[model samples]
Target chain A: MEFEIEKIAQLSRLSLKPEELKKLRKDIESILGYIKTLGDLKTGDIEPTSHVLDLENVFRKDDVTRINIRDEVISRAPCVEGPFFKVPKVVDKE
Target chain B: MEKQLYELTLKEAIDVAKAEGPWEIIRAVIDRTALLNPRLNAFVRFEPEHFLKKSRKSEDFKGVLSGAPLSVKDNICIHGCETTCASKILRGHVPPYDATVIRKLGDAGAFFLGQCNMDEFAFGSSCETSAYGAVKNPWDIERVPGGSSGGSAVAVAADMTIAALGSDTGGSIRQPAALCGVVGLKPTYGRVSRYGLIAFGSSFDQIGPITKTVEDSAILMNLISGFDPHDSTSVNQTVPDYTKALARNVKGLRIGLPKEYFVEGIDPEVETKVREAANVLKQLGAQIKTISLPHTAYAVAVYYIVAVAEASSNLGRFDGVQYGLRAPGKNLLEMYFETRNQGFGEEAKRRILLGNFVLSAGYYEAYYRKGQKVRTLIRKDFEEAFKEVDLILTPTSPTPAFKINEKISDPLAMYLSDIFTIPANLVGIPAMSLPCGFTEKGLPIGVQLMAKPFDEEGIFRAAFALEQEIRIYKRKPKL
Candidate 1:
């Protein structure tokens, strides 16, 4: 199958130069060529192991113990207004 | 004072700090780091003043790692310090809170030396991919230090720090440790908490120790391994005093030699030394048997798909919205594209792209699903093997440190470096790399020992026994 480099980069929120994409295409092809070997393995009836641990549904008591690092966190924003992280507007004005 | 402190192990340093003082020792490490970091590039960022202030109160503290300096991998957050993950994305960013491990280490009185360099977002096997520039191996400056924990390993190897913390998501810790000729342990997947570590592949990621000796790895393991309410994956199992597991008797211990690890691509010297190490274990009364982990060949392929799939999701948070580098853009989507494009290194982009492709529509079943199913087969290989043997031993890396740029262009070759170490991460087992021998060229080689889940004691016992039988730990690379 042909790998769609541009589409994948767009989906991944990355913008690569044409030259860089050309090089990456070759590398990705090589990597996927190797990865395709997994298809040859007989994995029938094998349960997909997403996580190794058996622990599940971990719960913690609801409490007002959260640390107030809001100011500290907002301070790291590239652009901030008061305690808010400023970002470009998502909606277009009609 | 520097020479004396450099010679002492983590255990010995604590004793000396208690008897004498920690000021001189702390200053010596800082001085050594200052002296060597220029050449080794082992650190991404260091705060000498902050370290000096902390060391002043070191004498009054009473913890097992008291006053011993530890260089942390750049990915682990340390409050008020740069946690760049050796990438441009986190440029000018300082974490507001410490990782759970950092807090634990501080509570234990371990002094923070600085932030060590690593593969950008822990993406590469060699440190070459780091935005901070490649960290040179202390053994041979011309060769690349195995990474993404390369800086941490180099720091310990060069005596720039007593020990360092490195996260392993597919051999980041063990590979570098082996290449640097230090003892590195990747504890059981859930053994160490992952609360503060910058996530690479959350399922496989673990924070482990890179130290000068096997006992030092145990010492650091005791301090870090435990259940954290903050991390859901962290097991509630009783954390054992790992130091007690350092008993040298491996008698009656069944060790398995996986035939697949000693394949054609493995360096002859590494194979010879590891075989000698297995023999040494046999002479020490442990039973050695040839074993087959048939699915081992599929590990690297499976790991890349699974790791990148998870990484793509994990790294999606770095979209220039909350913190980290933000490129100017007319809209939010453009901003994310620009920021990531300018922020991430080449390898990080490649992995993110590939990860997204695997999880993309029409391809998920063929790639991601198949990868996870084969991941089960890989895990089952260990499960079946562990039922018959107490531990599995193999060469930590196929070869010693390769010359810088030797395999940088070929990502596949770089991925192959982790062939022996990746399986343990896949299975969630505890594994370690300790010095076994060196090549005739003086480059260090290490043998890997893996144990069943939460059986850190088993791996520690076997490693300690082999460590005692082999005196290779005494040899230091002359910087």
Candidate 2:
């Protein structure tokens, strides 16, 4: 029942206002309370099922197939510079 | 008669297109959509001029569904069209290429009608969570069409399009289809390629059809079901001609009625109608038996844990640098925080938070791993029951659609609505919802049919037979 809503939101890369944090805390508490029902059934020996089918190591031939959608993909970005997506400066200036 | 062309099912429209060409049908559907969309809010983006222009050139196109108008859920990619998943963050993100299903539909000459609205990030069971606004149920405008795929079901129910494609991750397709009195199928997980579906619980998501008739669903399954090398999870199993499965014969078929699903808390009317559907199948020479999926009680809990954990990982891509909305910030980390905080709706944020909490360091072993292990048990329950029956029957939703704001504020109540439908998604099996009957207030009820993994043909065989016997699909809402 004790959820650190601010910490979770921060981990999720989401900024939450104070009121929003309050509401999210209440909702997450109730949802987690419901989710706690899974503890009743013991799954001691069962293997976890990540994917239903037993498909592994699905490697395609390394041959290159030309799909030229550079402009189309780049055009959707919110900020774009010539042939590259523009982003905020990450490194600190010396 | 031409004015009612929008009412034609996908098969009927295909035949009409062959004789009269695709223009008349296209124009009829466009006119119908224009008239109905304003009231229903089913379409987020409808382009009459675009469809008309395409219809003009479709005269030379030929295929099984040649020139049939198709409505796509906003979550599915269409090369140049905005695929937003009905959320603010993805509002203007247009994909550079089509989803594999979209490509197949295009090759089959199915002209796009437009994108239908959905719950933001396919999160809510009621359509109220859609950022565009809630889609009103055509059955009763005050009520909600069930969520996530609500717009697709509404579009098909109101005859705004011949057929629509909807992705089901925990009953997104079937729940809405049931509420709207249309047929919806969630194919076996790997039966259809997931190359272009915007991921929401990657293991649970599967794109399928919502249509007026079971036969139309079969036609779409034929076109969209296949292995795509692009999606490694798509099974290499051979895709059968599903239309051939619509033989209307359930004689000697084994149908199991799960005792857990028929218990208390279900609307009496929904329970009765689903039981009646089982009897109808029984009378048609099929054997009906009582079955137990004992782990059913824990399906919702397990689904919430596993699905959200996967979704949180999949949704990590939505930072400001790429597609969609960008919020201003001084630093790179601040940019991500601002963008996500602004982009996500309340429900999306709640789910994302829950996802992060469950997968966070100390909680990982208890929540995520435990949920996955229980998921194995749920799958085993179905595997054991399939040994007794070819298909399992249950109610698609606990009740017919509720009032618009009824469960919007209460997230737990909304999650419980999908209790019967979630197990199929959890187990990666094929399941469907078809119109069964109506309530006293005229709301439609649907009965669910679930089959073993890769046994969609069995589902079609039983559903097509019940559909023929009951004829519930003939009833339509006066929108």
Q: Going through the candidates in order, state the TM-score of chain A alone for each one.
A: 0.89, 0.90
Model 1's CAPRI class is high
Predicted complex 2: CAPRI docking category = high
Model 1, residue B236: distance off in Å is 0.3
Q: Which runs of model 2 end up more than 4 angstroms from their true locations? A: B1-3, B51-56
Per-residue CA lDDT of candidate 2, range B1-479, in tens? 34488889999999988777777888888898999999999999997566556444764447877788899999999877888999999978988888999999888888888999899989989889988999999999999999789999999999999999999999999999999999999999998999989999998999999999999999999999989998999998899999999998999899999999988899999999999999999999999999999999999998889899888888899997889999998989999999999999999888889998999999999999999899899889999999999999999999999999999988989999999999999999999999999999999999999999999999999999999999988888997
Candidate 2 DockQ, CA atoms: 0.87
Q: Measured against the native two-chain assembly using Cα atoms, what DockQ does each of the candidate structures obtain, in the order listed?
A: 0.85, 0.87
Against the reference, the lDDT scores of all candidates come to 0.90, 0.92
Could you say which candidate leads in DockQ?
Answer: 2
On a 0 to 100 scale, what is the lDDT of residue B386 in model 2? 94
Give Cα distance to truth, residue B42, candidate 1, Å: 0.6
Model 1, residue B414: what's the lDDT?
Answer: 91
Please give, for every candidate in the order listed, the TM-score of chain B alone compared with the true chain B.
0.98, 0.98
